[model samples]
Target: MSAFTMAASAVGVKVTTTAKRASAKRATAKASSSAFSARKASLNGVSLAAFAAPSVAASKSSQIRALRSAVFAAAKADRSKADDPDAGKGQRVMIIGGDGYCGWATALHLSNRGYEVCIVDNLCRRGMDDSLGFNSLTPIRGIHERVRKWKEVSGKDIELFIGDVCDYEFLSATFKKFEPTAAVHFGEQRSAPYSMMDRTKAVFTQTNNVMGNINLMYAIKEFAPDCHLIKLGTMGEYGTPNIDIEEGYLTVEHNGRTDTLPYPKQGNSFYHLSKCHDSTNMIFCTKAWQMRTTDLNQGVVYGVATEETMMDPALINRLDYDAVFGTALNRFCIQAAVGHPMTVYGKGGQTRGFLDIRDTVRCIQIACDNPADKGEMRIYNQFTEQFSVNELAALITEAGKKIGLDPQVINVPNPRTEMEEHYYNAKNSKLQDLGLEPHLMSDALMDSLLKIIIEYKDRVDKSLILPGVNWTESASVGQQLEKAEKVKA
Candidate 1:
C-alpha cells in the first residue's frame, strides 16, 4: 500500500482500540453487585467504583471531569452548610453507626432538620440483647420496624443497610450505592467494661473497632473519594489530663518547628485505646490519601429520647441497660426502672463531659455537614457540661424523688482504672459555632426515660443488671470460670 494509505489505516486502528477500551471502562463502572446490607444502600453510584487522585488524572477526560466535579461539588456544599447556627435545616447525611444510641439520636435530629438520611448497621445491639435475657431499657423494635415507624411519624423514609463495615466488599458496595454526600461512622465496640470482660472481649474490641474504621476509610477511598467522613472519638482516649482539653485540634509553638499531634491519646482502657488506635490509623490514611475526616471527641451521653423518639415508643431505639453494651446514662435509667439504686463506682468524683442524647445526634449531624478539606482531619469536642458520678447520682436522686420514688445511689467498688477525681477542662466551641444548641440533662428528659422504662418494667431482670467487669486488671478465662464454679460450690 502507499505511504498515505498505510498512515490512514494506522489511525483507524488506534481510534477503534481506544473506543473499545473506553466502552469496557464504562461497562466496568456500570456493573452492580449484591450487598449484604439488609437496609440496602441506594443505587446512586453502585455501578461505578472509586479511584484515587493520581489515577484520576488518567481518568479525567472531559466526561470524567464533569462527574468528578459534580461529586466534589455536592460534597463541598454539604459540608459548608451543615451547621448554620442560626436555627435552620441541616445538611443531608448518612450515619454508619445509626443503629446505636448516638447514631439513632443523630439520625432523628437530622431528619427533623429535613436532611436526607440513610443508616447502616449490622444490628450488633440486637445480637447483644439476644445474648442477654433483658431488652433495651425501653421497648425496642427491629431495624425495619423502626424505620417504618419513623416513616409513619414524620412521613420521611430513611434508607438503611444492615451489614458489617469490616466486609470490604459490602462496604464498597454500599458506598457506591448510597453516593452519600457525608457519612457519620459510629460502628465500633464502645464499652470499656465489656472490653475488659475477658480476653476474648478485649480481642474482639481491638479487632472490631480498629478494623471497622480501616475498612470504612478504604471503602471511602474505593467507592467515594470525595465523600466526607465524620467519626466519633472519645475523651476517655485523652484520659483525665492535667491540661485543658482542646476540642479536636491542639496548637504548639515548638523549637522553630510546630506540629499539631492528635492531642496524644492517653487511652484508659482497651475500648478507649481502640478508639485512639482508630483515630491514629485514620489520621495516617486521611493525610496520605487526602481524605477529609472529622473526629468528634465525645463524652458520656445521657438522656432518654430525642424529640422524635419521645414522640412515640415505636420510634425509640434499642435502650440498652446491660453491662455489655449499655452506656452509663442508659444503665442509670434502667437501674431507676428496676427500682434498683444507681451504682456509682468508688471515689465518685470522676468528672467527665456530658451531653443529652439529642445533643449527641446534633453534634454528629453538625460534623457531617461540615466536611474537612483535603489533607485536613477536623476534630471537635462533643459535650455540653461536666458531671461527676456523685453529681449525676444527685441529679438522678432529686429527679427520682420528684416522681415519688426514691432512686438510691450505691457506691460500688470501682472496676476500671479511671481517675475518680481529676481535672476535666475541655473546650467545645467548634460544634457550638456550627449551630449546635446544647440540651442539658433536664429533669424532664430523665422523667421521659423513666417513663419509657416503665412501659417495659416487667421485662427488666434485676439479677443481670450489674456484672463486675474489671478493665484496669485482668484474670485468665480459666481462672474466672474456676472462681465462678467455686462460688457455686
Candidate 2:
C-alpha cells in the first residue's frame, strides 16, 4: 500500500486497492449527492427544526445535514459580529509603519488591549540603518520574527502587511482587506538630521513623507471612509514661536476680525517641514471629505522597553543612539554607558517637550479609544514634560554616578542654526482630559536606562555619538551628490 493509503487507513478512512476502487467510487458518488443536498439546504437557511423533528427519519445523512446547518449558522453569526461597527470586534486598527520604534510598541500595546491590530510597513527604517552602517544598540528581530514572537508570548496575533503607504494600490488593497476602524500613521521619514544630510535625502524625505500622507488620505476616503486617521506629527512643526504654543490651532485677533486658524508653523528641518505639509493635507482631507483625523504633535520619546517588548527577546524594539536618529536623552544614556563625554551642543539651552515610551503607547491607545468627530480634525500636544538639553545631560550624569560610573558632560559647537535659549511652554491638556495619566521621567527610570545600556555597552560605537551633519552646509554637489544618487537609485 502507498504511504498515503496507509496513513488514511490508520485514521479510520477507508483505503481501497485498485480492485475495490470502482465500488468505492460508486459509494462515494451516492454519499456526495446526499452531502450536497445538506449543504444546499444549510446555505438556504432551512430550519434545523425540520431535521430534528421525530416525523423525519434520522438517517446518517440527516445527522450530517443538521451538523452542517448548525456550523453554517454559527459561522454566519461570527461574520455578522465582526462586520458590525457596534460589535467589540470593530476595534480593528491598522498601524502604518508599525515595524518602527513608536509604531512597533503601539502595535503591541493595542494588541494587548484586545484590539484587532494589523501592522503595515515597508521596513525602510531598517534599510536606513543598513545604509548608515549602524544598528539599534539593542538587537531587534526581523519584522516577521518579531510578530511571531509576540504571538508566542501573548497568545494574540497581530496581522502584518509589508508594503509602502505611498503605493496606493497596495495600501488600498490592505485597507480593504483589514477594513480598519482606525488607522494610525507613523509611516514617514522621522529624523531631522537625516533629512538634512544632503540634497537627495532632503528631497526624498519630503517626497516620501508628503506623498505617503496624501496616499493615506485618499485610501481612507476611498476604501474606509469612516476610518479614523491618527497621524503622528512632530512638536518641531511649531518651532520656537515667541508666543505660547497651543495644541494645533491658535486664535487670532486681527484688525476688527477674530477667527481661529492653524498655528503658525516655523518648522526647523526638511523633515519637520514635511510634517507641516502632512498636517495641512490632513486638515484639508478632513474638511473636504468629511474624514475624521487626530493629529498627534508628539514630543521626544525616550526609553526602549514597554510591558509588551520586554516579554521576549525577539519582541524587543529598536534603540537608536546615533546622531542621525537618536534623541538627546537616549544619546546621553548610551554615551555614559561607553564612558564617552555627553556632548551638549552650544549652551544646551534649547528646550523641548519629552515623554516616556510607555506613555507614548498609552497616548496612542487613548486616541484610538476616543476618535474625532466626522469632518473634525483634532490635535493633541502629546508630551508629559519639558526638558532642555542641559537638563537631560544632567539627569543622565546623576543617574550614571549612582551606578558607579563617572559620566562627564561637555559642550560642543551647535551644528544646527537655532536659538540656544527660548520660551518653550506648550499646552498638552487634551489627552490628559481624556484620561491619559502621564509617566514623568525620574532618577529610577534613568538608572534603569543606564543598567540596560551597560549590559549592551559592547554594541555601542563611540564614533557615531557626536553630531556630524551640520545645518550650515548647502546641499551636496560633487562626490556627495554622486553618493546620494547611488543611494537614490
Q: Tens digits of per-residue lDDT for model 2 on 175-249?
A: 878877789999999999999988889999999999999999999889877778999999999999888999999
Name the candidate that leads on lDDT: 2
Worst 10 residues of 2 by lDDT: 81-90
True-structure RMSD, every candidate: 16.3, 17.7
**What overall lDDT goes with each candidate model?**
0.71, 0.82
Query: Against the true structure, whose TM-score is highest?
Result: 2
Q: What does the lDDT come to for candidate 1?
A: 0.71
Encode model 1's per-residue lDDT on 1-489: one tens digit a residue. Answer: 242243223223221232243333223222311221111232234214333334443452654565545544543443444432211222335688787788887777676555667898988866765764646656667778888888777666689988998888888888776666567888887878778877887898899899999988888777667667888889888888899988766778788888876686788878999999988898898889998788888888776667678667787766667776666666776787678888888879998888877778767665654457777898888889888878888877777777767788788888777788888888887776555667777788777667777778787777657856776556667877988899999
Deviating ranges (above 4 Å) for candidate 2: 1-89, 477-489
Q: For candidate 1, list the clashing residue pairs, or say none.
A: 38-162, 39-160, 39-161, 39-162, 79-369, 85-435, 106-361, 136-319, 137-319
**How well does candidate 1 match the true structure, expressed as C-alpha RMSD?**
16.3
lDDT of 2 at 11: 29
